[model samples]
Target: MAEVRPAFDEAARTHPPLREASSARQDAHPRQIRDDDLAYGLERVLDGLAARLEA
Candidate 1:
């Protein structure tokens, strides 16, 4: 793998701090998670399993 320092410095013009990186990721994927999404996903998985068993 390529050394990361050179590309990182070129991108940030200095060593980017942890706060900047964390904030970028958090902004891209907000933390306000919903239980409804999880439940819906689980329901789909269980439904698939039930269908397979019936087959």
Candidate 2:
């Protein structure tokens, strides 16, 4: 059986421009998961749970 490398490697080899475009997009919009954002989400979930429990 042939060795199967990662799909990403195959894609990178097949289409170099696609890799460059993806890298550019990542650089443009980096992941910014701030603590405040997580806290806000947790607060919303807790509020929802409290409402459900009270209902």
Candidate 3:
């Protein structure tokens, strides 16, 4: 947990510029939530539930 912020900042600095997104992309998600973000979040939640059930 202590190293997470530094690691994230390092990755952000080192990563290459991303490709341009569409206008709808900007309008729909001003907060920078990309396409499929909901699906990805749902998958993560489901994984956590499965792990808890198994435990």
TM-score of 3: 0.39
User: Candidate 2, TM-score vs. the true structure?
Assistant: 0.41
All candidates in order of lDDT, best leading: 2, 1, 3
How far does residue 1 in candidate 2 sit from its true spot (Å)?
44
Q: What is every candidate's alpha-carbon RMSD to the true fold?
A: 10.8, 9.8, 9.9
Model 3, runs deviating above 4 Å = 1-35
> Each prediction's TM-score against the native?
0.40, 0.41, 0.39
Better of 1 and 3 by lDDT: 1
lDDT of 1: 0.60
Worst 10 residues of 3 by lDDT: 18-27
lDDT per residue, candidate 2, 1-51, as tens digits? 023325655667768897775555442323343554578899999999999
Local lDDT at 51 for model 2: 100
Q: Give the TM-score comparing model 1 with the true structure, all chains together.
A: 0.40
* Residue pairs in collision within model 3: none
In angstroms, give how far residue 43 of model 1 lies from its true place: 0.1
